[model samples]
Target: MAGKTINPTRMELTRLKAKQKTALRGHKLLKDKRDGLMKQFMQEVRRTRQLRKRVEEGLAQANAAFTVASAVMSPEMLEQALMAPRLSTEVTVDQRNIMSIAVPVFHRAEQEAQPDLACYGFAQTSGELDDALQALNRVYSDLLELAQAEKTVQLLAQDIERTRRRVNALEYVVIPENQRNIRYITMKLEENERGNTTRLMKVKDMVLQDAHHYKS
Candidate 1:
């Protein structure tokens, strides 16, 4: 059944058509935004995949080195050598906008001097331990980058889904409803107009008959 629209007049029809036009324009804009976001989301996804692979490889290398070092060195000696740290790290978080979405950016403040990866005495610690530490340090920046990319991808995916749902609602629900209302109003108005025209014609015929009878 067609949905009923109250006061099916020309004015109402005009209003409904205007609303439909606006809805179509808005739907188009939202679709464009969704597409743009998808493109950016895919870019971030690819970057995250590559960074994750690199991070995993670096960690594996470091773990292998640690395993070799453990086999040769005494646990007590390793513990004593790595028990204390000499470097301090400061992490700061900030945000940047991407397509109206704010994403986190993490930074480790630059140090006055580059810290030595070697925390243990060379005389006592195995060279394998040093290699392991170096490997881990090498991937520190990559790890942060991977985190940023993954987070950006997550946010973009959420926004894309939201935009898509809204677009669908306008395309399928709001616009269609307005169109139905407009059609109903137009039909009602035309029907009323035809009825009025027929009534006027009947009145005109009766008046002419009365005049003819008076003349007779």
Candidate 2:
């Protein structure tokens, strides 16, 4: 399989050597990138786990508070109180590169000034409803952070897979093939040189014999 399509010459050998060197260098760089990405991915996974737990607990508390409030207050009154929301928020998305992977960053962009959770009058709403709203509000930042961390993990995983494939191709396929081709070309050139030297020696001996015969 070696040098089947390759020219067995010194020029071809030199070219293959240069190509092998480049492949090896690229393989090393990609391996480093993969390692760095794995490190960042693991850190992001840990952070996402923590944020998810916090968000879940906060949501559970809020749900319990809402249940209590619903039981104590009339349905009509509760519905009326929550009909109009006083706060408006927007989310701003940005990206940062980690090991050449672009990952999302989320920011809680408020359309209006930050306002209290109490959208309704205290006299009209139960304390339980206030607690529920406060609990939900507290988890918003963590929810955003969790989203960001999870997205980062996803992006890192994809880039790592891509880099791994390239490394494998160079290590298992490209480098070895080039090395075989180089050896084939070198052997062929050496054989040709030996053949030429043998022929030159034969010619020299024949010339000495002919000159001696002419002298006799």
The 10 consecutive residues of candidate 1 with the worst lDDT sum are 109-118
Tens digits of per-residue lDDT for model 2, 1-216: 483688888888889899999999999998998898888889988988999999999999999999999999999999988887777889999988886677888999765433665777888789999999889889888899988988888888888899899999998999888888888888888999999999998888789879786432
What's the C-alpha lDDT at position 42 in model 1?
87
Total residue pair clashes for candidate 1: 0
Task: Give each model a TM-score.
Answer: 0.91, 0.91
Clashing pairs in 1: none
Error of 2 at 161 (Å): 0.4
Name the 10 consecutive residues with the lowest summed lDDT in model 2. 110-119
What shift in Å separates residue 171 of candidate 1 from its native position after superposition?
Answer: 1.3
- Model 2 scores a TM of 0.91
Encode model 1's per-residue lDDT on 21-99: one tens digit a residue.
9999999999999999999998899899999999999999999999999999999998887787555568788999999
